[model samples]
Target: MTKSVLVIGGSGGIGSALAQHYAATASVVTVISRQKAPTQNSWHWFEDTLQSPAHSAQCVQLALEQRPEVIFICNGVLHDAAAMPEKTIRQLDTAILMQRLHANVAVPAQYLQLLFSYITKTAGVKVVVLSAKVGSITDNALGGWYSYRMSKAALNMLVKNISIEVRRLNPSAVVVSVHPGTTNTAMSEPFQTNLPPGQLQSAANTAERLAQVVAAVQPEQSGKLLNWDAKALPF
Candidate 1:
C-alpha cells in the first residue's frame, strides 16, 4: 500500500528535511508550514493566526481530510528573534513563557487531538512529535532554559496521556516523543559552540536517523520518549 505522510512545520530545518526524506518514498506527502515550498506531493500553507484554538481546529480539520497514515509534528520553538533560552530564573518572562507554551505544548497537542478522529482505530497509525531530551523530567541534571524546558515537559506529559488514550482507542496506533539531538539547524546555531566536534548533525542526517527511529517503534512502546538512535529515554 502507498504510504500517506503529513509533516507539520515543514518549512523549518528538520521539518523540511523530513518532508524531503519521506517524499522520496511515501506515496503522498503533505506538508504544512508558513512558507509554501515546492514539494514533491502537496503543500498546505499555515498562518500564524492558527495559533488560536478555533483557527487551529480548522487547520487540523483540513489535515485530517488527507487521512495520513503517518503524522509528524515538527512544530517547536527553543528561541526566536525576540527571546532566547533563559539562562537564569531572572530571565523568565511571562510573554516568552506563553510563546513557548503555545508553540511547544498547545500547538502539538492540538494537532494530536485533530488526528485522533482520522487515524485508524485498529493499529496502523503512527504519530511522531519532535521533542527534546531536556523535556525528560527524570533526565534533567543541568537546569536552565526555563520556558523551553517547562513547555517541552508539558508536551511530554501530553504525549504520555495521548498515548494511553490512543492505545485504548486503537490497539495498533502509536504515539511517542522523539529527541532529534543537537542538529546544525537555525534553532541550534546559537548553541553549536557548546557541542563537541562530531556532535553537530546536518538536518538531512538527523531526519534520516529519525525516520529510522520512527519505523522501529512498536505499539507496545507507545508513550515512551525515544532518542534519534531509537533508545528509550526516561520520562
Candidate 2:
C-alpha cells in the first residue's frame, strides 16, 4: 500500500526533485515550501520561525497531523551578504547564522522529535534530511562555510540520536542524513565555477540518486550519514 511522504523545504532544488520522484508512488505526497509549488500536489506556508525553537516547532507540529511516512528536510542557508567571508567564521552574520542553525539543525531535530510517534509506531517509516559534504567535521578539508557546515554536522548528530531512540519504538523505521552531492541549485550556483565533470548534477539527477539511496537504505544502517551512493560519511 502507498504511504504518506512529506518534503520539508520542498522549494529547494533537490527538494523539488524529491517531490516529483515520489509523488507518484506515495499514497499522498505533500510539500511545504515558502511559495506554492507549480503542481497542485503541494501546499505552501510561511516559515517565519526559522530562528526560534517555539516557532520552528509550530511548523513541525502542523505537519504531525498528516503523519508522513518519510520526511525530507531540504532546508539550508549560506550568507552571501557578508562583507567578508572566511572559512572559519563566514563573517559571523549573527542573525543569518542563527537562522541557518535553526533551519539546518534545530528545526529538523525538533521535527524528528515531534514526528517520533509517526515513525516509531509505524512500519517502514523513514526520515531523510539533506546534509552537505562539508558538514563532516572529520572531512572538512576545504575549511569554508562554517555556519552551513556546523549546522549539517549537528543534523547528523540529531539523526544518530534519533535512530538510537527509534530502535526501542519501531524496528522497521530508519532515520538517516544524506548528502545529495553538489547540484545546480540556486544555493550552489555561485560555486559552480571550475566545476568537475559529473560533479555538478541537475536537480532531477540529484533527486533520482537520492530516491535510489532512500530505497536502498537498510534499517540496520539507521543513524548513519550516507551519500546518495549509499557510502558512509563521517559523523
Candidate 3:
C-alpha cells in the first residue's frame, strides 16, 4: 500500500530531491515550502515567521489538520559569518549567536513543537530532521564556527527530546536526528574545499543517502542519531 510523507523544507537542494524521490512511491507527498512547491501533489507554503511562539502556535494548529504519516524537517541555514583570521573572541558579536540560534535551532524547534498532534496520532510515523555532523558531542576533534555548531547542537537536543516524548505518546512514531554530511549546497559551498578528497557529498548524494536513512528507521530505534548511510551516531 502507498504511504504518506511530509517534507517541511521541500523547495531547496536536498529537500527537493527528497520530495521528488518520495513522490514516486508515496501516494501522499506533501511539501511545505518557503517558495511554491510543485503543483502535482499536495503543497503548502510556510514563512520563517512561524518560528515565533505566537505564529508557530497557530501554524501548528493548521498543520495538524494535514494528518501526516511521516514528517521530515529539512530546514537549516549555515552562515559561517566570520571566517578564520577575520575575527577573534574579542571582536565577536554576541547578537550573532542569537541570529544563528534562531535560524538553525529556534525555528526547527518551534516547528517540531507545533507538529505534535499529527505526529503522535499517525501510525508508524517517522520524523527526521536535517542536522549536521559537526554537532556531534564526542566527534568535535576540530572546533570552529561556534554559532553554527551551537545552533545545530541545540537542534540535536530538541530532536532527542522529541523522540522520547513521541515514543511515549504515539509509540509508533520514530523520531530521530540525522547528519547529512558535508554537502555541496549554498550553505557549504564556501567551505567545501577544506573537506577531504571525495568527502563533500553532493545534494543529490545527500538526498539519496537520506532517503535510505528514512527507510531504515524502525519504531524501536527512536531517540537515536544516524548518519545518512544508516550508521548510528553518538548523541
- Worst 10-residue stretch by lDDT in candidate 2? 40-49
* Model 1 misplaced stretches (Cα beyond 4 Å): 38-55, 120-122
User: lDDT values of the candidates?
Assistant: 0.83, 0.76, 0.74
Error of 2 at 7 (Å): 0.7
Q: Please, what are the lDDT tens digits per residue for candidate 2 over residues 28-79? A: 6666666644644444343533556576567666765667767788877754
Candidate 3 lDDT (Cα, 0 to 1): 0.74
What is the model-wide C-alpha lDDT for candidate 2? 0.76
Give the candidates in order of TM-score, highest first.
Answer: 1, 3, 2
TM-score result, candidate 1: 0.91
TM-score of each: 0.91, 0.84, 0.85
Model 2 pairs whose backbones collide:
none
| lDDT string, candidate 1, 1-235, tens digits | 3277778888899998887887777546677775655644355545434646777677667766667777899999999898999999998999889999999998888778877766546357888999999988899999999999899899989999989888777879888899998899999999988677889999999988988877888899889889999999988
lDDT of 3 by residue, 1-235 (tens): 3266677777877787777777666546666656743555454444444535776566556554666666788888776555331134564456777777887887788788778777888788788998888878788777676777778888888988888888888997888889888778877776777678988887777877887787778988787778878788886
Give candidates' CA RMSD values in order. 2.2, 3.1, 3.0
Off by over 4 Å in 2: 24-27, 37-67, 80-85, 88-90, 93-95
lDDT at residue 87 of model 2 (Cα atoms) = 53
Among the numbered candidates, top lDDT falls to 1
Model 3 poorest 10 in a row by lDDT: 80-89
